[model samples]
Target: MFVMGHNQLPPHLKKFRRLVYISPVITILSLSLLVWTYSSDMTFQFITRYYHATSDPQTPVQFTLPLHRGPGQMGPEEQKLSLMAVNGTKTVLVAAYQEHRTGQKEVRIIAVVLRSETVAYRCLLRCQEQLRISEGVSTTHSDHFGFAYGTADIMCPLPLGCETASHVTVISAASDSNDTQIQEFLEVKNQKVQSDSFPYNFVVCLSTMFDFTNVLQLVQSLEMLQLLGVNRVVIYKTSNSPETQRILDYYIYKGFVEVIPWSLSKFVNVSRGWLPEHGPGDLHYLGQIPALNDCLYRYMYQSRYVALQDMDELILPQSVNSWLELVPLLEMKYGEDKCYMFENNVFPNTVSLPPPTSQTLPPPSCCPGWENVSGVNILAHLYQEPIITETHYTNFKIIVNPRAVFSTSVHGLLSSLIDCSWVDRNIARMYHTRASRQTELTEDELIYDGRLLSYSTKLIPNVNAVFRESGLLPEGSIQ
Candidate 1:
């Protein structure tokens, strides 16, 4: 039965047997090849390019050492290749080994490395290109190049000109490479940005040139303001009109002022209606008036506060010590959010008689303290109230609460669209009668000027009569 079964068993069965025998051996051999590729000390010492047999023109052949074996000799039978990373840089290791009677002996290993030589070459090209650009020799797109090797630093100092070609390009190229082992480098960047700290608070900008002789006196008047503290006091000129330009130049030369020329003639037009032949018949041209409408517009629209005044009207000391000392005291009495007016009492443009042989009843000193002193109210006397005569040259002292004030006119307005009870504080006073000997006026003339509609000189007989009538003083100085 066994002998007859050989041919009858059939061709298909024989083929199946052959297949089973070959498949396992093929698999095992394939595995062995892989193992050898990984573990054997088979070095690909250098890379060289070779074209297929049918190339027309031969291309340049570049050779690079891909691996190096340490000095050792061994038989090929037991060599095993392995993979390794040196200094975090990936490399392939090919090991050599020998078979001893005991087992196997490792001889040496060769490391196959792919370095950044290409990068270095490209870097050289970039440097050359940069030189070309700097020299205006040629415009080329090949200005960027990158090369990296063996765990190089990210902040690599390029050899001068290489990075000058295009640092961003080089950085980008380095970023694109898969070799994460390379170090990244940064270039010196030049950019400036301003911080947001300045220009927050309100400002009172005084753009005038100070007259040297009278500047201290004028500043003293400004310094006497018991209201908000002065922000910036800029003096650009000194003296009256004839010497005004020269004084301005002097301040500019001394670096104490910024001169801005404004024509007094231009303002004459607005003043034609608002001002008399002299300045304001009631007050010195303070609060910018109508002349500096542009400055007023900017201040009203752009700035937080607007304080326009000239140099004479000063807030005199009441019971308080200095201007700085008076602000809080006044604020306490009249709520911190309020504006005030200090009525000026002095008459301007009066000349002294020659050599006062009899001693001109030492002109009535402009005084602040009087009887009946209260917050926001004081029965103070004035030589000439701007309210009456056409010569209303009396300056108005004002303290504007930034939050409550809007655009100013002949009078001030409130930002809040409602009317509130207005309180006056007499604790803050203004003395407006400091004048040169060149300017003086009799008490009778001051109190009872003929031009006044209500209180006229013709209506009153003398100083004694007026003082007695007003019940402010006794009849001692009156003749």
Candidate 2:
């Protein structure tokens, strides 16, 4: 019987022992070498810089993620997002993000392209080894608001074993010519989106602000929204009066508003009206549909629900006090798929003050402190157009679950798993306090609902505080 001893082993055994002894030393030396390499200038530029997509891992990388393969210098500039125009095509890329909800591993690009333009899109996925080019499935949204330019979704499926994408860009392909044109790479969002990260119960999406100077109404409406359970309001602003910007800034400072610069005019001439024939522009309402879609994706994982509304409008709950209260009741009845369509009951801004209500009318608005303000006073107009008692109405707004929606319109959802169920006016309705589109209706035709008046007590004080803090109102003017 032959046995092996530690010191008296065979030559191969001795060699194996020496190797085992040096293994820990080799491992330690390798680790130390790595640490030294990283800690010193010996580190490769590609290795350290490309480790994280962003400096602050919690926040997303803005407009540009550091890569240099695209043709353009950069695209449109909103605060932290990009609006890139594809070369030799009418296609404009608003934002690109990894969408996991659709059961396809793809980069969903929200864009505004011509309804009939046969622009073939390719998704340039920033992969680990190579820039993957995948043919994108383009879907031009149905609700284009009768405009030439419509909101489209370019779904580019990710390559095999690609768990996450670094960044994404869209390229225009020519059928006649074999050359594909690539634009700038946009920060692919929603991959790092922490679901329910914030406590915003309802987020409001005001499509665009074009030449807006309505200060008084903006304040009242913003305050009213806050009171009605809106935690955050995302405003896509093109240009606004300084006074209006100040109000927007105040909300932004308060962390209640996100102002995304709407620079669609830089790329395409945006139409002032819904139809292209109504003006000499290309897209409708300053690329509002794209903005709405971007807003949807932006907050899809951030909030429970999103309300698409105008600055002058508020979707007030009739039975419930706040939207936080209202949405749960709706979801309970509709099972999370119903887009809570509220009847658009316009309260004419033409009326100086509504007929006196039972509650003491404090100058029909925020008391006497708002006379110098430049916008509409929502509290002043309590009477609105009579609710259309039918099952549906043409003019209506919606409060929707962002996850359930794919594409959005100014008034409703274009593509949503969410079915439109007109919320009973008794449950909730929209107070669209704009210049009367119902000018044909007589003064007597308008109904004095006084529903908005119920919130005037708290709204007035809250508004007064905002005005006083914003220096919009006189310090001692409590009259």
The CA lDDT of each predicted structure is: 0.31, 0.75
How far does residue 29 in candidate 1 sit from its true spot (Å)? Answer: 71
The parts of candidate 1 lying over 4 Å away from their true place are 1-229, 234-259, 263-273, 276-306, 347-395, 414-425, 433-441, 444-479
In model 1, how large is the Cα lDDT of residue 335?
A: 55
Q: Give Cα distance to truth, residue 398, candidate 1, Å.
A: 1.1
Q: Locate the minimum summed-lDDT window of 10 residues in model 1.
A: 135-144
Name the lDDT of candidate 2. Answer: 0.75
RMSD of each: 41.7, 14.0
What is candidate 1's CA lDDT for residue 248? 30
